[model samples]
Target chain A: MSGRHSKHDLETTPDDKLLRKLEAKWEDSPTRVLRWHKGLDVRGLDCNSAPGWDGDKDDGGALVAAHAEELSELQERLFADGRSGGSRSVLLVLQGLDTSGKGGIVRHVVGLVDPQGVQHRAFGVPTAEEASHGYLWRIRNALPRPGYIGVFDRSHYEQVLVVRVEGLEPEETWRAHYDEINAFEAEVAAAGTTIVKVALIVSKDEQKARLTERLERPDKYWKYNPGDLTTRARFGDYLDAYQELFEKTSTDVAPWHVVPADKKWYSRLAVTELLLGALRSLDLGWPPADFDVEEQQRLLAET
Target chain B: MSGRHSKHDLETTPDDKLLRKLEAKWEDSPTRVLRWHKGLDVRGLDCNSAPGWDGDKDDGGALVAAHAEELSELQERLFADGRSGGSRSVLLVLQGLDTSGKGGIVRHVVGLVDPQGVQHRAFGVPTAEEASHGYLWRIRNALPRPGYIGVFDRSHYEQVLVVRVEGLEPEETWRAHYDEINAFEAEVAAAGTTIVKVALIVSKDEQKARLTERLERPDKYWKYNPGDLTTRARFGDYLDAYQELFEKTSTDVAPWHVVPADKKWYSRLAVTELLLGALRSLDLGWPPADFDVEEQQRLLAET
Candidate 1:
């Protein structure tokens, strides 16, 4: 309430001021509270709800736009920190069913920052080379280097979710992956990479609507997959698989955040807010110059 | 003058309409005319000049902004094309001396598009692993996959430019890189990748001023390098090296655009325009649906 302002006001405010104002308004971090915990029922969650947001699509869009500058600036500082000997980075893991807005988050939210500072990888069905290695091998190779915001469109959890539900691996094989993933994530987290695991949950009804819309538009056909329909047939199994995976893999080092993603705008806003919170938690300062500034200035003047 | 309009008009027009209007205005492609030639003298090029643009900073900035949506859309179409069985991609190779605005172009120009579709790699000094391989090995590995725009901050040209000037490699070794690079680029271009090579040319005076500015700002300190002063001392040598480079390697397949980059805004705008022209030349259209749309739609509706 303290930082309440019209969209126009938010647009015109200077970056630091707007960032501070938005921070004041979002001090409680509603999106952060969405972190997955034991006993949380995935089946009971609302698909279309916007959690702490009460605005329409336009207002939600405006809020995301307002956060753009702050997010961009924070990402730059993070990059600068890494360039100046800081090894800290953030990894955002996106897992969702078909048409659950994983690509949308990448376009609308992760797209807000400098591309130089982001490492985005979309993992589809593993290739021959990838399948030859451990499941985490490709994920390990895709981890963001120091100073980057690494995005995994579909990530390691596919091992537990799809691999489990589809019986691509034996139950014993897939079940052990939960602990292996947790251990891997804990190691990454300890080595200065903050992991943000997000599951974008859309209802079966919403998924039908989305897939129908994709089929209705010629421009969207490339995004459609017949395999998605095959996967959709076992929707209940996927939910159960995700529920068990969340319970086993959401750890002290890196917990999961389940976002209701029927509304594309809200999912984007929520992800952006979650990313903002992760970055702000770094509490970075501009890396100081190791060289003598005045000496460099004098040397340059002579040149 | 076909589509010349005020900045306000550009900001308000719809995306497709604006794209058409701007395409008409840029029909002659001024930035493309800046492409390096066999006899062109790199030393004689005016670093402060804006080439075809006569506007001041505000207009230049507006022009770049106007191009943003169209560029973003074209990039998306490029991505879509690649996603739906197209192999074509764009590689914007940015080679410049210290303080020449390579990073700025990546941030302001290529940054206009989706990060999901961008593969950005900044090649610094070769690591032991990189050094152990053939010079082009890392370059090959970093090439953009289908559906991506790859920006190399400094590219293989460093072998010819810095390696030659700094005596890092013997003259015969560095000299042979020209044909190797040309052959390498030809193969890439033949494989459906359009390579846009850019050399951001900044004068010695401008470099001094920019370095001094970096030294003056605490926030920019990390960007400054003491070694840059050492490089500045060899400015003329670099120009000579670049001149010879253009003569030897400016192929029909991957011609270099030597941009005068003293003004940051002009360089950013020019690079944006050059990239715009490259994407436009692709003559891309949205990929059509691969599946039976009506059948898919019916199935989704039943779901």
Candidate 2:
């Protein structure tokens, strides 16, 4: 209402100019959001890079708030579209090393929309049952049904990432998973799920600081996994695994986004904006009402 | 402890004689269980017939009890075996006309196992999303994960059965589904899932009687779907649909069993026995312990 457009116009617009404006500002902002393309040389990419948000914690809060209303309304349209024969949905696959503020992204970014609209699955060590199926089997089951946004805290990448670094399976076994995973993602996309995968890149110094803080604070102990240090010690191997992961899996259908996550607010805002872009790309509209609206209006007025 | 042989012996036996003995009694019993084989014509099959249970309600109760303990034990072992790495499971696909006692079989037959070990998905009208994918997409999502007994209240056969009878889609569409379903089941079976399908056959009069009873009782109103009567009106079309369903979709990986379901008690027992036979065929053994037993025992004793 305050700008050239009305509130309704903002809500219904396919690609709202406001969203594009905010995104443009984000492009030049201190905190950097990395978009993965085919044949990305992840080795050259620096984990410490932020879009360059060197401001205080409160920085970018106003921009996130500006887009919040549109984001919320767009999420509803996405849900409604899916329910009404659209049969389409979004899956945000979040993967990163420990203490990369994965939880913050979930809490601050995704938390803006209706909770019921989001399906969250946290992948842990595979159950003997899950392990029995090809690694991607449980993934298929956890996929969001139509009319919902699905978030994977960690995903099938474990087959390549942790499994590779830990030497849990023979190199021959885990190595083949990259292609299988690519094919699987391709199939899932072909079946109508738009996949937006994000890797939260945190610097080693930043990770050390977060882990040390967890140790010092009793409140954060529950979030702490001692295994994180073990994983961190093999950071080079893990980084190489991720490099291969990006190179191999960043397909046209489901591309991976690598965002520097040293700043929690910047990362959260980036993810929120990333999801906004994904949802907007669907060009979702409100579903038509099933019942006779005129008759319902008459009945309600009479009652 | 009271049995003549040890419990371990019975569990370890490839095919227990006692189970076979009970199964043998079932073969000659008045209430007959339908076993479909290659080239068997389903048209000749009698819906009104049941394995004769001349005795009162208590007649087969003892036999059911006899197997209950072992069945329960075997189910736990199946769960444990899967947890250890076997990744095996059984899917009981139940199909039949209205008032065919699919619910009763779910309750009385499948109810014998631990609730945690059973994955029951009662499919209803397909969501727009489900229809967008091939008919089997939702079915795949509903499949039993490893280490569980999965039950389909009604299944993909509806595409060939109800969808066919009602002309919900073109003849070309429903006709192509049978081969697709067969190939799908074959893959599911090859993936370590043992599929057992049963259609509880109740005659027209029996369905009529059940529907009337539901109409007369206020308590049973919830179970009554008026659409069931409409479905009953087109019985011949449905019957022809089934005959085609049996002829096409039944494969080595998953087969259809047409059982006499006029008698709930007898049919329930027959289905229970059918499932038991399927599970026993897997020749499951308890998964070995993960820890060193003697050392753990010594540590506990010392403590």
Candidate 3:
């Protein structure tokens, strides 16, 4: 694995190095992924451009529009194969802070797949009946069948993110979930399910602007919760809690991709690439017909 | 209302009569709709087609491919709008019997929508926990948010379809869900969610060929369950069950469009039109920004 990494880590390969650099830079700051994981002050990032930014908004929009089409096409092909073949499944889990754009990401990424083959489950406040069961039960039921793709707007990671952030559960209970999630995902992957985990990262200022926008916009007023303001105020604590989460749970089976969500288009592009990249790795294809073609043709003609 | 009907029915201009005839001819057979509502009996469908019936096989393939590309491009536009605006949501529900081409319709229809705006939920047997709650609870929770689109492979209608068919619930419980569903969908629509419901109707002979192919193909073995045969054998009971469902549940609020699934391409085409039609009705646009053209021009000059 290290040798494989070294091959891709060629000095002349600027793209690989740039990606590595971005990942490292994100790792150092750490706060973005943390805010996403801890669920303490989950604020959505501003996707719109900043005033006086260097980029031309038209060009930026065009680039995003093109990429969106590519990703959308890839998702459609993958979905068609999955629905028809019935051999494999895919699960995309998004964990992000309040307004971290988990919903946004899902709206964009899973939206590309066929509604027949893809399933989306948003884990909110557990119902009394759901709460009665073990923590992972509801999550388990939401898993897609063979040949389907399931997207979790918020997922089993909540046991670690929210329960731990609010101290709603004992230390041991939340801690146990990291292993449990990894195990559950492993089982899923082993059953031909591809799991992609993403944490939508937003900066404090970006979040503040979004929350303010939400309050001002009449159409968006429905999404603004009064409690969210208090959550936003404790931003630093949320950061720390999330940083701890990323370090512990990011694993080989289901690696966490920290999406730079301040640029919503960029975030959507990255997530789309991540998913398409995963599907490409699967080498999916239409299943071959079983019987002899000529014989079947002859038989049908006789009938 | 009767006068309006009489104008089209008894005394119409030639153009109007042609239009009415066209509409009536295109309207799906109630029996075809029932075949989908009840699981399909694939063994019954006639498998007698001349050489090369598969759409992917010839000159017909070229035409279909071109048509698909056009649909795909339209879908690309929808996705761009969905990601940017994120204001209105769409829900497409596909309900059909085994081999009725629910998956096929999903593949084809979803092939047309922007992946960023659509969420697909495939509802199956409820777990003990899910069953404990009202049947529609899990389905409702999976509804798409504002500016998103949700597609359900099997939906809340299962309360009427499966529960009623299997005698899992009393007549009153399953029967009343028709009104309950209408109310539920109305609420979602009021909340900016557009519901597009489709029942894929495949001929009995087309179904038989599909089942035989499923049995013969190793890769398709996963889709072939022992229960499907038992269900297929009881086709008449299922048809009666579904015809009643369609008659009672099809309403102006969220009318059920029956797609001809005998031809996979036709099914895809019909569903794609129905879905795109619903989205088209939304009249979505980019959020208006307070942009000053002259000020922005000066800003660009400075850059």
Candidate 4:
């Protein structure tokens, strides 16, 4: 069949024939959505998978599982080094909508890493004291010290997201935060602190589905906040604001990745990739051997 | 029951009630034996009830459980304060025998604190790379930044304890470490970091009981090392060294608390009291109200 004819055939077939669909996508890799970064218009890049771009979800899951393991190993090695040297450190920021899988993503990323070296922080509504300080104050205090990896569940972006949506601040003040955030991230980057920011963007429909699941399961009731539905009512506004802010703020110093959060598996995969990409940027190594043999012998004899 | 007869009865009884026993030894406080201080005579403190004071323990379980709840509460309050403030921090150091409840203490301390503001690190044997650096380099790096509470499971004391025990360094070198540690801790204290040091001491009999349990449970086999038995065999010498070290090392700057490890409940309670004393010293308070009328109006408008 001609290339054009094969492409046409793919468009009408049922998706269960995923192997055939993937083959066609690979054949058309140069023009496919998965490889759609050629133009580099990050804004225009169609993150959504079309007929050909959609492949085996299981493959995606497997890829995530594999990469997560690899990343976890790297994270552990980094942690071991940091704990001993006690100098360099890392901070991972997870910014995603509800059910974008912040908690799950953290579990996978640091699953194999030593819990000793990794710190997890979940940012909720600011307390009255947190509000007394600048928006970044609470977050600034939460950054990890040397030789550790700090993970933020919902980070300082609440300044731009919730505070903005809630009209907690004047338009002029909150609008200025994009630059302020960019500056803050740049400062952390300069401090030998590596910051990996991930924005999990699930579709409005997916969010509603997750909310419904929470309502149906008694175990998930703690996660169900009636306030979230009120926020759901303004979902479109939140998305528009988030998209604009993300576009304006993603930078070379601290780039932000908008992961396709509709599928938890895919979200996990993209996040692992992002984390590996960030950590790989750092050239870390194991500590060298330097015990004094005679001294060690003497100490052993004393024992 | 004449007073003189009752006092004579108490003197002859081997085991008094827990609180009374503790009070009887309050001024002497053998728990202080585990602490780093000057003037302790480990060899002299050797007795059946004071087994941990002379390195005669195979288990420290009861000592660990004794202080779990209070330590748990203090950790919780520390993290809560951290969440409220944008910049404040604390550090908890656990140093003890091979099975002196370091791991158990870490688990209990961090159990209730939010994973975000609290980071736990267990420092063990130096790697090839770590041995090349100054002894305290690795530990210095793990200090939590502002608004964090970093727990060190083993910590820098290995220089004085294990290193000295193993004769890894000259007497001059290990002896010098006490002052070095003092200076280092003073600096941390000056930096608004509240440092709590706990040493778990278990009687040899108790240690043997725990070792037996570890052997009986397949899952705990990994925790038992044949080398520790050798250390136990030379227990008297180790105790003498520890006692001398603790007596000379414990100072007004950073006082050491030698917690009895035979009864987990008693040990846990002592740790709780210590933490409560430390945190209570900080004078933490809720942030004053900060929302202005306009901000309240915005919230009202949304409502």
- Which number leads on DockQ? 1
Best by TM-score: 1
* Candidate 1: clashing pairs of residues: none
* lDDT per residue as tens, model 1, B204-295: 88888888878877778889999998899999999999999999989899998998999898889888888888898999877888778888
lDDT of 3 by residue, A1-303 (tens): 012233224464654554444334322322223223433332343334231123343433443444444444444445545546555767888877777787666655666555555666778889999999998899989897665667888888778777877888999988888788778778877878778777777777677767766555533444555566556666666766666667677666677766656777666656665676666666654345434545543443343
Query: DockQ (Cα-based) per candidate?
Result: 0.69, 0.01, 0.14, 0.06
The candidate with the higher DockQ, 2 or 3, is: 3
**Against the native chain B, what TM-score does each candidate's chain B reach?**
0.91, 0.88, 0.73, 0.74
Cα lDDT of model 4 by residue, A82-172, tens digit: 6455456778888777776787676555543445657777888888999799979989888887767788899888878888888988989
Across residues A1-303, which tens digit of lDDT does each residue of candidate 1 receive? 112243325466565565455445443575556888777899888988877665677767777888787688789889999999999999999999998999889988998888889999999889999999999999999999999999999999999988898898888999899889999999999999999889999999999988887776665777788888999999999999889988998887898999999988888988999998899899887899998888888878888
Q: Write the per-residue lDDT of candidate 2 for residues A1-303, one digit (tens) a residue.
A: 022242555365744655455455654522124577665555556655555444444546755776766676676667666656778888999999899987667756765665545676679899999988988889999998886788898999999999999999999999899889989999888878889899888877788777766554433443455466568778778889998888888878888888877877777777877887888788865555554445433332332
- Count of clashes, each model: 0, 15, 21, 46
Ranking by TM-score: 1, 3, 4, 2
Pick by TM-score: 1 or 3, better one: 1
Q: What is the TM-score of chain A alone in each candidate?
A: 0.92, 0.88, 0.75, 0.79
Worst 10 residues of 3 chain B by lDDT: B45-54
TM-score for each of the candidates: 0.92, 0.49, 0.55, 0.51
The complex in candidate 2 yields a DockQ of 0.01
lDDT against the true structure, per candidate, is 0.85, 0.72, 0.61, 0.61
Candidate 3 or 4, higher TM-score? Answer: 3
- Which 10-residue window in model 2 chain B sums to the lowest lDDT? B1-10
**Which digits, one per residue and each the tens of the lDDT, describe model 3 over residues B1-303?**
011232325666764554344334334532233223333333343323211122332433333333343344334334444444554677888877889888766655564444544566678789898988987789878897665657788888878776778798899878888888888888877776777777665565666688777666544644555466556655666666766777777766677765556667556645655664665566653343333434433432332
lDDT of 3: 0.61
The candidate with the higher lDDT, 1 or 3, is: 1
For candidate 4, give the docking quality class from DockQ: incorrect
